[model samples]
Target chain A: MKKLTLVLTMLTLSISISFAQEVQIHGFISQGGLYSTEYSYIAENSKDFSLDLQEIGINFQTDVSDKLHLGIQLLSRDVGVYGEGRVTVDWAYGDYYISDALKLAFGRVKNRLGLYTTIQDFDFLRTWAVLPTAIYDLGLRTVNATLDGVQIHGNLDTKLAGNLDYAITYGKLNLGRTSDIAAYAGQLTTYAVEAATTKYNLGVNAVYNTPLDGLRLNGTYLRTEQFAFDPIHQTLDLTQAGMGVLNFDYHIETDIDNIYAGAQYLFNKLEITAEYNMGTRHVKEYITGLNQTVLDMIGKGKPELSDEKYYGGYLGATYRLNQNIGVGGYYQIYMRNDDLDDEDPRKSTSDIALSLAYNIGYNMVIKLEGHFVNGLGPLSVSLNDELTGDLSDLEETWMYGVAKISYNF
Target chain B: MKTKLLPILLLLVFASAFAGEIMVANTVNPEMSAADVEKIFLGKTKKWSDGTNVIITTLKGGAVHEAFLTTFVKKQPMQFDNYWKQLVFTGQGKMPNSFATEEEMLTFISANKGAVGYVSDARAGSLPGNVKAITIK
Candidate 1:
């Protein structure tokens, strides 16, 4: 069934391309070093240096005809690492000219979750070395780069003209499997349902942007649900325990909601920008065990889990000393409250980063950046230990700098 | 000090006095709208009714060409520069052919059937025949 669906989508796209008046290709490659006190799921407390190779593929409209257009992209990253991965079809959709005042699209497209996601293509125009994680990482919790579905967009041609845009999507999201030990140890595997575990997802999102003079303010909201495998064993034992197993008849429900507002202003030789974001996550499920050993294990020492809420924001400024020389910096902060009363290692945390960049030429940019991270969370747990419950030895602060060079074709 | 500054400012103004003006040429039809003229110049219209390829000649990145773009296109100088940069970089379009003087512009336009070029209104008829001036604003 999946093969048939894929083949049909390809056939439709081929037909459209044949009759298309004009088609154009556009893209860029960005490579830089990411030095952090925290790196991955395991080394969340250790400082390390890693290189990220980011590329953005673009297919844009070259001819305007019949009020209809099409575009798509494919991107790959970390080509040589164990965690290297690729995201094909970063964006692909069709625009239907409803009228001069309105338009609609179908297929996969940019979510417009925040300012950066909308103009990710216009890298040269950006003032920051990298987008603030507070906005990009938080807003990306619900979906990947694009969603398969429908979108409606319109603009007013007046000075104070009101513009509106919205999108709703329904599709499966495969986040891949988790190898982290903490999450793995928590899984209650059952023989009965382990064979039936399937990965499928669904979600919906919307965004609104309003322009006022040289600045534009934006707001976004999203909701999603995914199927996660949970294990239910009759008992818990390190080496001696045997019991029948069954899959819990419960699904993990995930809710992701957020609001973002920002503005960009252009002065004679200076530009400034700022934005704020706030959001929360909720996971609800039910579990049970058949025996005392298992029931005692499942009920006792279970981490107090609840809905998580967090708030983050950033401020940035840029000055063009001249056409060839420019400098800028931004400060971003992210704070999270797990709502767990216990002094769990997964308590609240904060991260702050600052950067300055220079435009060597029209096609080249070099930058220096540093980060100060404090208050670690379970998200930073190291799995190298055999009996890992919580990590209390993680560092509270890490500092490093990086230089990045980029060119566009 | 006042006398010295006055002479220097006068010299600067005098040096900038010959910045010149901009005009659009009318080869096929004299009654073309400013929008239609822009369409032809931008390579969107592609051809004249006579089925000849449209040719537009202007100074490459010059003050007069910049002024013409600023007045007619409503784009900042830097933005207009970037527009052409993307077009050329993407290989979707070509830069306009350039010449040094109005006589050169007229010669190129008159020789090519679908050619269209622009010059100052004062120098419009210096060539062989009566050349119409298209509306640009």
Candidate 2:
């Protein structure tokens, strides 16, 4: 703890010294209440509303030279079982401008995956209290937010095609045991699991700013490999028919590939956005003690899991009423098909959401949002720890409401 | 007839009060287009035509600042702030220098070679010898 206090003191002093120069300090605080009608969305089910969702972040930036800059952001958040007011370094990177069309960044930088992922936590920058759950799911926040490594980005201007902005990044991500993904994965096993770590992550994103005003087209691609320790299990032991028992010291390896395409257009006071995402995952389990009987019972010749594919997208529109108020709505759908059967309701999910936001002042905003969800989707499985059975016992339809207030400066 | 004309005259006066024009250091080349101005302020254009770095400055809050954004940058103050914040947080770009008044803006632009800024049209005539208004075409 002495080292931690020393680090904090140094950070405070550095911020103060930078402020004396040309540093920029900006921050935001957001608080909200979430209520579900049938099942829990982000917290345990309760008769009264839950105020377990909130976030605060502070960002500091300064230029070391004309072509070199540094930035860092600290964030603390609480959402159900994750965040819990833990102050973490969201991003800290050094950027060097090589030229007019080339720049490089190193350290912990935000991942440029999709349109909304880079700015996912900045509620003051969006019209809704929360982004679309299908694309920017809260359970996958840590995996999608930042990477510790290097990034190269720039813009290319053309006479005919307008401007093209591109970014390529390579890095590794550290996933904590308490992360939402680990917690959810742990529920699938009986052992006390640790956090998963990635071998490496690579991504590329490009955006074409068309000649048409307020219109842009974008595409992103990312690939990563992750390894997690089961440490006490091969797979969920189905010997007791779903009442599984675990063996010891196994390794789970997964490879993922994702692609996203998005478009945005603005006309007068109206804004329209649409995006589609597709992902594929391959999983291999390494178990120490595996017999032919276990393999035959699991219906697999080897300890390999079947490949999974999922696709989802959303179409959204927002209309501004003067400058202080805005109204928006969206329809989104997702399908997870490990069995390749479209007839199964468990494979498909859908949701429709409506939002109203009012700017209380230049730096403060209040938003009210509602969502009606259909089908037992990924959210239902990951969010609720009580639901131990399969999709057959899950609620098919549910609704939730949220009221959020935020201030930024 | 006079009563009806009074509101129109007052509206015209209000609009004219916010009318502003872009300005640059006299050392900068005189061949900048409105598109170039837009690109420079948006951080899309990092250098001048002569390959010298481009310095961008803005007034924090004023009629001229509002008019400059609406007429050229095509964004509100809040939207512009959010845009730069996004870029800064993502390590793509940095915020330009901002002044609290037109006088400070003019002083900085006058002292710098590649500086670009805006001022009210009425105040354009008072610019010093080192600064000049660039017509947006």
Candidate 3:
């Protein structure tokens, strides 16, 4: 059905172009090589080169009239186990310009959640091959990047304060057969979980351009809803708990609230950036089976639902030695549960990164970066680093490196 | 004749050295603030003060192009290009039309309503009657 919709949309766009207006097409392609130590950072095993990161995209934009425009981008990526190289409609929207203070857009619109949400695949735009992982998780790209809904956005100028570019959006998530959310759930628990949802998401974003050149301040808020999973592949086999290997089915539900504040300053050859975001999640679980009663009796009588909060941010700076060479780095941290003690291994994850990039020309760039990491954020240490069974062998301190080359036109 | 032409030649030499500066031109207005020029080119200001859609044009790439963009948009050429490309791909705005020569850009601005663009000061000397060179305040 998604493929059919894409074909129909493409056909309609082609017809419109042939009979009515001119359309501009642009695209980019990037490939990356990765290697990590002490865990399955990106590959099946650590310490081996993995060429699992790749991306390709093509976009179309056309002005149908003085006050109307249409645009769409089809993107494909395979980064480890996330995208799997399937083409997706990254964003497809129609915008109507009502005036300078207001514009209405409908369809799959990009979410301006943070300084980098909309530029996830724009490798050539920044010196970093990947954004700060603490806040911009690659695993959540499928849903956090864009939405299928409506948006109202515009610019307001205040003579002394500067210009405010703002947008408000409401939409629904496109839960598909293959989504990162399901994979993320499976990683946390050894189960075949499928994500199902029809909940709507809401977001508001605004950026204030400072009177000082090369400086801007941004703030954003988002309320996103998703995640309802059915019973696991099979119920838990609780033989050790005196329950004779019983079975039970359970369902899970989730809701999320997010807030972000950031600023960017660019002066001459130097650019500095800083951002912080907090994510609050509410989760509820429903157990249906006789074994659940025994589970409560075993001192595991925790509440069926609870609210948890996580936060992360990064401070980075990039400098251009010349057009051909640039360097950047950032210090970032992600607290999976801020309430946990500071020294707990599961409490948080932090990484310090350094990157260098060289431009081959105006159209191509090559970047090399390294990340020194501490902790696994929320991932269980018991997870099989090699996916072969035993997750008991792990390290708190690890490092990874990636080199990528990208081209666009 | 020699005395008179020497100062004229000196003045011409000085003007030629500074003629690399780009002048914002449009048929809709004869003058505008540099701040407005910055907003218009960045896709932030979509409509003119008169409510007509602001049509933006650009030189394909050259010294004049770089000077105008860096002077107003405050971004390097490639960064500016990347900025618009990001907006275009994200379905946020349209890419400004680009021409290889200043004359072609001039023709586009003259023919289109509310069209705004930058041209070499040398080209501003002979603008069409419909197109006016904007005075950057």
Candidate 4:
């Protein structure tokens, strides 16, 4: 951590001295606390108040030419054990504008997956302490927040249709064992696990600004190929051959598809937004050169890995009481198996959240929020790093509250 | 009766205090419409009709800035700041220049070609020849 801080300090000083002519510096910091009544929402054991949610980031941008610019952001965040307040480079890219209607960027760019994915780290931009968790799960931030490759984005203006903004990105995602998806997969296996990685990721997002004022519609689609490796150590009692013990490694591959549609209408002091997301993940295991007995034991009665489908959405409305105060509420629902198999009662979850935000000034905001949640569904992973053998062992309902303060410049 | 008339008098006073006019550098084409001005300030239209890049400037805060935003941009001050920050951080566009007062804004606009800004009607009375107040229409 000290080394990381030194590096960031050096970079900041160098940029300030070398490019002081036209560089723009922007940053934000937020600290919040979460408390749960019966279950942990973000931390492992936060039945009481937990101060494990915070984010700090700084970004710098400078123009290289009339049509070219370079930008970079460094971030440190702590959400339970996931981020751990470890400093990491969030985005670094160069943008080249070919025209007012077309632009290209290369390097690490924020994923243009959903409306809020790119701006999720900017707490001052939104009223909620947390975005709707159903669609913008903080646990999947590593896999869904950014891509290391190229993106083409721009706006198209038309006489009859108003304007259409779009972005298409192709790149790879980096995932580790600590990531939510990898952790969930590791719990299903019997071994000590290593980090998980991905093959490639592709996404496209488009928004239409209708002729009607204060209304916009958007859609996004993303696909990724992922793989994880886990090492297993066991004793093989080959009495006939006098072999004692052996260690082996196995791996699982997953393919994921995500689709989202959303709309936002802003009129006067009231803003209403609604979004729906559906994700399907398929996993398969591979173990080669294993003894027949061990192979049979591992594969014999295990259910054929089924495609887990997730469906979630939220409808939210916020009304500004005055320039300094706002109030909002949302109803969110999520289903792991949209097919609705009666035998799986833990496949669905629902929650309602209410928030009140007060703007201390143009650069600072404070918010309080409460949530009443029903069922575990996809959020069960937050309860414990390891998943129990049966979903029935998990709590079915819970409540949590959060208070946050944020400042930006 | 006095109580009701008092509120109306205050409203008129507030309205008169905030009256302002949009201004542009003499280098601008001088043929822009209200829609074109709105598009420029919103970062939607990047260039003038002649294809030269358009530079936008604004006062950081004041009655004139708020009035300009509500009248032309149709957004609140915070909303406008958030909009530009989104564009800047997302690598979509750069933020426009902001000045703390009308004199600074007018100076920048007068010095830079293809620049546009706004000022209170009272400040517009003493504007130099190089900067002209443009009608919103």
For A106-212, candidate 3 gives per-residue lDDT tens digits of 88888898888899878888888889977787777876888888999999888677888899999988566665566666555566665655488899999999999
**Model 3 pairs whose backbones collide:** none
Per-residue CA lDDT of model 1 for A110-174, tens digit only, reads: 55556566544334545456566666652232244455556665443332443333444444443
Model 4 Cα lDDT, one tens digit per residue, B10-112: 0001122335554554343535544455567888777665555677888898878887777666677777888898877665566899999888887777666
Candidate 4 regions with alpha-carbon error over 4 angstroms: A1-20, A176-194, A227-244, A289-305, A339-345, A381-395, B1-20, B23-27, B33-35, B49-51, B91-94, B133-137
Ranking by TM-score: 3, 4, 2, 1
The candidate scoring highest on DockQ is 3
Best by TM-score: 3
For each candidate, give its TM-score against the true structure: 0.63, 0.85, 0.87, 0.86
Candidate 3 stretches with Cα past 4 Å from truth are A2-19, A230-249, A288-303, A339-341, A378-394, B1-20
DockQ for candidate 3, C-alpha atoms: 0.49
Q: Which candidate number maximizes lDDT?
A: 3
Candidate 3 lDDT over residue span B25-100, tens digit each: 4434445666777788898888755555677888878888887777777887777877897787687876798899
Docking class of 2: acceptable
Global fold similarity of model 1 (TM-score): 0.63
